[model samples]
Target: MDLFDCQIIPVPLTAERQSHISFWPNWLPRERADALLERSIAEIPWRKDSIRIVGKTIPIPRLQQWFGDPKTSYTYSNIRLQAVTFPEWMDTLRESVERETEERFNRALVNYYRDGSDSVDWHADDEPELGFEPLIASLSLGAERVFQLRHNLTKQRLAISLPHGSLLLMGAGIQGHWQHRVAKSKAVHSARVNFTFRYMNGR
Candidate 1:
């Protein structure tokens, strides 16, 4: 399997002056990955919640559990978030993520896609609490799912399959220029767990 490797190059996201680089490393082995996923499942209090979009609530099949600093507990669009102290396994993964992305994170929002049907809608993490151009480091495990990105202004689409134990980082003005989502798939029988680390500013 030819996965995308790390390279130092200036990524031209768009004509807009967005600046960021993704260093996707094959850091977590299958055994360690399973261990982390199982441990996180035990620690995080997963909840199934509805999201209000344009004054209408929608079906979001997955449950989310958050941890990190105590000041940010965002539940909805721009929902305020408070952090919980990190578990040891999470702390280890966080350190690895930080090293790969070269960004510091104070919080992590974890999502458990219990089956192939679970998904996240296309949205940008552009809340006031995230400040302007916040960075997000996402780690995927358990199953491979396609993560899609669309240009908010041009409608151009890009897709990448997120395999287990892989990481993707987005930062700078990328959030302002594009929106991303993990669309549903029907061929997989197992679940996938995604952990997105962010440094949220208290709104």
Candidate 2:
């Protein structure tokens, strides 16, 4: 996709605060995206991590892996993910994302949604380890999904249909004031893989 083919979406954080999201509907060609999706499903060492809730342990709906400096670890919802060294292919993809977005990313959290039943609940990437006002660049491959966001105070909501090969950048401060999620839908039967690239200090 052309670098100019980006959509900037304004998100209201508060009466006096605002942020934006940058999205590219066709960040990668269909054929390339297809190949990447297949390869990722086959090659990545996916983990079925579970979380404890209400004194019971339940597996997350999707599989995931964390990639970055092995010295650093990320924890959220009581699940601690130790960083795995980035493989060559993922590093190359990260470089490409940085080039397109003009943002530095040293870590990535990859999620694999097997089908319609796999979903993520609303949450903010506001972990203290991520620092304040973290920026996230999320790339989607394979099936399309609806990415929804909701304001913290006003409860206002917005949804975007993310197509295969699309890239969406959650700008600074958005995570601080809004929460987002990929909800389940029976209409989506195919698989999808999302790569959310982020930067960590001291990495």
Top TM-score model = 2
Q: Which regions of candidate 1 deviate over 4 angstroms?
A: 1-13, 16-25, 52-59, 78-82
lDDT per residue (tens digit) for residues 1-203 in model 1: 33457633243467756555464646578798888778766767776677678998875688887787555466556443455677787888888888877788877888999888898889987777677789888899888888888878778777777777878787678788888998888987788899999887542
- Candidate 2 per-residue C-alpha lDDT over 59-149 given as tens digits, one digit per residue, 9 for 90 to 100: 9999999999999899999999999999998899999999999999999999999998999999999998788899999999988999999
Clashes of 1: 9
The Cα local distance difference test for each model comes to 0.76, 0.93
The clash count of every prediction, one per candidate, is 9, 0
Most accurate candidate by lDDT: 2
Clashing pairs in model 1, backbone N/Cα/C closer than 3 A: 69-83, 72-81, 72-82, 73-80, 73-81, 73-82, 74-79, 74-80, 74-81
Can you give the lDDT of residue 159 in candidate 1? 73
Evaluate model 1: give its TM-score: 0.85
lDDT, candidate 2, at 28? 92
